[model samples]
Structures are given as structure tokens and as C-alpha cells.
Target: MTRFQSKVALVTGGRSGIGRAIAKRLREEGARVITAQRGQDTEFECIGVDFNEPEAADDAIATVMQLAGRLDVLVNNAGMMQEQLAEEMSLVDWTRNLTVNLTTPFALIKASLPHLRQTQGRIVNIGSTEGLGSNPKHAAYCASKAGLHGLTRAIAIDHSHEGIRCNAVAPGWIDTDLNIDFIESMPDPKAFKQGLGKIHPVGRTGTPEEVANLVAWLASEESGFVTGQVWTVDGGRMAKLSLPG
Candidate 1:
């Protein structure tokens, strides 16, 4: 369980939901975790900053290097999804989605390359099933996550020789706080949840802990040979094709 005894990890948006689970899992496995978030306080070593600002990426890396000295894992888990029709989504909304979901990870990767190269560290990007497919009123989210998927592959190929491994974890309908809130707000929460589970072959949605477990393996040496891959931890949702009932 102490696979990361000597490792230092940076998890963006680690204050809540999927990112929080990732940070907790890494810490449980004996890694010294540093969480970066906007206006949220975490029990772990945290850096409060807005990743939406382009410069925050470099600043966050600098802070991590200063605090931990060596970085072994960079989990780009912070992201936001705004729901709007393609035609209704404004330039600002589109830009915001891409900035947080795609560009922030790019900036972090660029800034961490030197340190990661030194440590032969790994990068685990928290992508989404939306990237692989599409959803109603999710144009911006899908586009940004698709960009993130491409970025993961590019980084894996570009830095493989340097001992850097980049992979993405694409999750679908995880039962996170954000998701729960949205589901509860629906007119028929029970029916909504049941419908979601029915669509997935596993008969249920996934959890943050499940996704974190996959991330831990990918970040650790156990998955040393894996790179440039999009691993879906979606309870087989992506593999199933629905038929008329």
C-alpha cells in the first residue's frame, strides 16, 4: 500500500469530488500530496490559486517544486463542465471550458516537464467519457475534454523517452457530490439514478474511489509500460449499446 512512500504528488482541484478522492488515495498510499484549488481549504498540503488564470499553472508548479523539492506525480484532475446548447454557448463560456479543462493541464505539463524529467514522474489526466462521445447540451465540455485526450497522447509520445508517462482516466457518471446534487435536483431523482445505472452494463454508476484506484495504478510503477492510453472507468458504460426497450 505504501507504493508512493517517497513520491510527491500535485493534484489540482483536489479540494473536492474526484480530485479530492485522488488526493486522498495518493496520501493513503504514503505519498506526500500537495493539493491546488481555488478558495478551498483541504486537510492536505494545499496551495490556493485559480488555475483558470494562465499564469497560475507556472506559479503552481513553482510552488510545488519549492514545497516538495521533487514532483513524482501530476494529476490534472481539476475541471468544470458547463451545460449549454452549441448555439447558445458564448465565446466566453467556450473559452472558459477549454481554459480550465484543457489549457490548464497543458500549462501544468509544460511547467512540470523539467522536474518530472528529473524524477521520471507520471501524469494522470482526469478526462471524461464526453471526450469520446457527446451529450445533449455539452458541446463545450466535450470539446475541451477531447482536447485533453489529445494532449494526453501528445505528452505521452513526446516525453516517453524522458521517462515521463502520460495517460488519461475517462470517467462517466461518477457519483460525486456535484453529480449527486445535480441528480437530486432533477424532477425524479430516483428514476434518474436508476436510468443512469440501467444504461451502464455494470448496473450502476462509478465512484470517485474506483477512479482513484485506477489513477493510483497508472501513476505508480505497476503501470510503467502504459502510456498514451485513455482508460475508461465507467462501469462499462462506453462499451454498451442500448437497444429499444
Candidate 2:
């Protein structure tokens, strides 16, 4: 319920999809939430901080402290995904992908560590099932997410002694607007959508709200014993073996 009555959370890219769901859920549970994104958002207390500039993370945290007075939860949800084959991907493209997905989160976490130490806060990183397995044309994306998972564990091991907890949520095929639109753009839209669901044992894709639930729990005090773990919330897709069609 009001476990976060006096707590403050910073959720990057909280303007849409999974990020929006996370921010909303945390706010619903009584946390004063600030969202950071590349563009301005009127719904939440938003700060425009592009992950492209990792230095922006420091400024963002300073802004959060000025606005909220303290930080209790840091949600590194902002990221990018570009599907380019390894051989075709330019060095610039490869670097940008890693910068947004991995480097920025690292920067943000580093900037927040001192404040988090003061409050004994938690960090929830938004990773992907790609971190656990490979996807076509996702060389950089997969590598970035895998690195993020590793970063999560390292942070937990290094900071748990300081009363900080770190964890990551690896989601697969969440029903976000971007995903729905891509599915709808297919020649056989209905068939394409069905294909997406069939990959999972649950017979459907996941929802942003489903992911938010896990993230909220991880960031809560109730998960005090939980740290250095990557929780997969992928509708059993990661566990089921696909049969030959």
C-alpha cells in the first residue's frame, strides 16, 4: 500500500509503454515519482535528459534531488533498439546502441549511488530476454542487454553492503504501441500477431502492466532480501522449447 509514502523514485523514459506503467504503478503505491525522457512530458514531473549524453545523467539526478529532496528508487528504463545485422552495422550505429542501452544506465546508476547510499535505495534496470538468448539482426541489442544484466549483478555485489539493492527485469514481446503498430503493418497482420503469441507458452504476448508489477515489487521494501538477480517476465517464452513447424 503506502510503502512509498515518503519515498521518491526516478523512472527514465517513463513517458510511454513499459516505462509509463512502471512510473504509474510506483506513484499509485504512494511514491513521489519523477520521470526522465528525451522529450518533455506533461503528465509527470519530467526532466529532459537524453541518454545519448551520459553526462546528462548527473544533471538529471541533481534535478531530482532539487525537486524531491531525496531519491529512494532509480529505474533505468530508457533504452534503444535498432535491428541491424552485425556485418552491416556501422561503428557509429553499434556505439549508439550500446550508449543508450548500456552506457547511459551505468552512468545514471553511478551518479545516483551516493544519494542511494544515503537512503538505502533500490535500482531496477529494464533488460530484455535477448540478454538470455539471441535474436536475428539484434547483435548490438543483445550484447547491450546482456551487459546490463551483468552490470545489475555487479552493482548488487558491490553495494549491498552499503544497503543498496540492484536487480533487472528481462521482458519479452510486451504489447507496447510500437510493437502493435509493427504487427499491424504486416501483410497478414492478424497472422503476424498470432505468430507473436504462439512463441510463448502463455499463448499471448505480455502487457506493460504485468512488467510494472514485477518492477514495483522489486523496488519495494518487501523485496529486501532480493538483489543481484535477473527476473524474466516473458510469459514462459524463455522456458518453452519450440517444436518444428
Candidate 3:
């Protein structure tokens, strides 16, 4: 599917997990892929960046423009999840979550606007199902992702005339190393893992590639009319009513 042939894409945090999957999908669809991640070793053209820094977003965009010559798709995929209750969540953690999950994507979009405008490119933000609803002890994460979805809509509205489309994908309980690490860190990893599938109506958690495929479609011209939307790929989890155990 050479839908992205002759295109260039920059994916944030493309070294592993969901971001990595998205990058691979874009590449397989024929886009030249550039990745901004913390590590130096990567198969894709890499930019070493720490999203915690305020300048990281702009710096990444600049690097991509210099190396790749142009940007056709921007995937704001790097994010942090701080699982803390509102009562126990520190100011530092709250601010960090917003910075990484919300502010960084905004900065990247702003920096890449000119180039994307030239190419009529697209932006796919990796939001979470938690943004649409809530979970126990995920106050900071939910708030930040909610802000990210808002940012997605604003960009879509503001840039549609410029030929840039912005949309977000909200994933639920994706089976990734990061998610596995989170589950393993739990007090009862086995029970948590065992029970995770039943929550989704599909009877299984989503895979990174599943989310990646949706992102690829959204990034392509096939979804040209889809913008300012938050698409949830949650294995039917969002459709089910929450019932007491």
C-alpha cells in the first residue's frame, strides 16, 4: 500500500511500543520515516530527544526538516503516564504529565505547521481512552490526555484551510511493553494480567499494530475528510457499561 509513497513522516518516541509500531506501519506503506526518541540506536533515521525539555519539540521538528527536507505526517506519539491519585499527585508530576502529553504535541505542531502546510500534511496524536472517561488512580494521565484531545480539535479547525488535518487516536489497554511493565509493577501482576482481557468486549486487549493500522489510515488521504475527531480503538471497551464486580 504505497499510500504514503513520496511522503516523509516524523514520529515522536518511535523507538518502542506504540510509537515504534506506528513508525513501522508508515514505513511499510512507503513513507520515509524519521524518529525522535531518547535512545540513539534505532533502525529509522533517529533524533535523540528527551521530551521533558521544553525545547525538545522544536528541536525535533527542526532536525527533521533539515535531514528529511520536508514533513508530510507528524505523529505525536511520545507520552508519559503518571499513575497517582489527585490527592497524592505532586505538582511536579501533574506539570510533567501536561508537558509531555499536551504541551509537547502543541509545540511540535506549531513548529511543523509551515512545512505541513506546504505539503498539506496530517497530524495523528496518540491519545488514550482514559481521556474520554476515567480510571482509578489516573488523575494526571486523564487530565493531560484530555487536554491533548482538545489540542487536536483546535489544530484541526485552525489548520484545515492550510491543508493540514489533525486527529487523535484513543487507545485502551494496548498490549505493549510499557503497559506490561505497568501491569508487572502492580502488586498482583498475574491476576491483573489475567483479568485485563475480560474488561474489553472483544475479550482481548488491543495490540500496538492494531492501533498503528488505524493511525496509518488516518494519516493517509483515505481519511482526507476525517479531522478534529478522536477515534477510539478500544476493543469495544468503551461501548460496554461499567458494572460492579
Candidate 4:
């Protein structure tokens, strides 16, 4: 049988990048996927809601439940990153990053909890390598992702008896549009990409499909015993402190 046969999944920020890949993979695995994004209409059934808005999380969950009848898996893959030093970062910038990256996932999980409990589902939160270790000019992003890691553990402990699993995936540098744009905007795009690739023990960046595959396994019965874990999918970037140093 297909891993996701008869399963229902909701993917936040499913318009592009990793979220999009997860949604597509879940659907291909026989899931009924409802993707939610801000103002983007996807090929699959999707809802338009800016997660930054007050009512967006609730509305997105309601829309998914209405269409799918139940929520079997929730992928909290929506996040934002701002490049600014601590001294230069404003309260608004800090709050924006937290609200979108951390708070939004909390809200979505809260809203989807009853349904998840009913179905005994799982949650796959997309974190970052930054959450594991600090980097320059990423204070707010790191804090938010770290908080998400904490939240994942809390949820696992609180709901394990109820058969709900919660986990996180901390991806290293992937070649997504965000990274592509960032590199293109640099003076030497090729060097920028090459430098990031060399830092990884695998000697290359990761792909969205690779992350999606891990998520699919976690969301399936294959990973039923796993919970409260933060799996890094960063081409072994987090494995060694210094690569070939």
C-alpha cells in the first residue's frame, strides 16, 4: 500500500521551495494535500493566507479540515530570514521573524492539535542549521528556530501518551530560490555558492526533494517510534565542527 494512502496533510508556505516539495511528495504518496500560501494559487487545492496575519493560521486550518475532513499530518515549513546585525536589528524586525518563524508554527499546531489527536498524526517542523549553531547576523532567526526545537520536544512530551508525534528537520544550506537570489545579488555568485558547498562535509548543498523525502518518512508509519527529535538534513554540515580542517 502507498505510505500516505488515505492520509491528509496540510503544508504551510507550500507555494515554493521545501514546502512545495513536501506537498507534492505527500500527494504523490497518496495523500490529500491542502497547501496554504500567501496570494499564490498552486496547481493543487490551496488557500491564500499570509501566516503573518492574525487570523491566518486558524483560517488555514479550517479550510484544510473542511476540505479533507481530518488532518493526519501537519508540516510547519513556513519561515523568514533577515540579514542584520543585533545592534542594527529593530524590534519590528525581531518580532517579525519570531512571529512568522516561531509563533506561526505554535499557533498552527495549537489549532490542529484536536484533529491530530483524533487521527494520531505527526508534525514535521522545518527548522534550520542556524537553530543548532549560531551564525553572524542571524540572531532573531536562530532564536526563533531554537525555540521551535524546544516546542517540538514539549509537544512530544505532552502528547506522547495521546499517540501524537512531533519532530523537526534542521536543513543546512539548500539551493532554494532564497539562496539563489542571495547568491546572485552578491558580487561573485559562483564563489558564494561554492563556498557554502565546500563548508558541507558532503561537498554540496541539499535539495528540496531530499528534505521532502525525510519528511515523508517521518510523517509515515515508518517513523512511528520517532518523536521529539531534530533531524538535520544539511549535507553533514552540522556533523563536523570543521570540515577537512
TM-score of each: 0.98, 0.98, 0.95, 0.95
Pairs that collide in candidate 3 are: none
TM-score of 4: 0.95
Residue 10, candidate 1: how far off, in angstroms? 0.2
Q: Which regions of candidate 2 are displaced past 4 Å?
A: none
Q: In model 2, what is the error at residue 124, expressed in angstroms?
A: 0.3
RMSD of 4: 1.6
Q: Give the TM-score of candidate 2.
A: 0.98
Residue 90 error for model 2, in Å?
1.2
lDDT of 4 by residue, 44-159 (tens): 78888888798889988998888878999999998999989999999998999999999999999999999999999999999988999988889999999999999999999999
Pairs in clash, predicted candidate 4 = none
Distance from true location, Cα of 173 in model 2, Å? 0.7
What local distance difference test score does each model get? 0.94, 0.95, 0.92, 0.91
Return the candidate ranking by lDDT, descending.
2, 1, 3, 4
Tens-digit lDDT track of model 1 for 212-234: 99999999999999999999988
Model 4 residue 159 lDDT?
A: 93
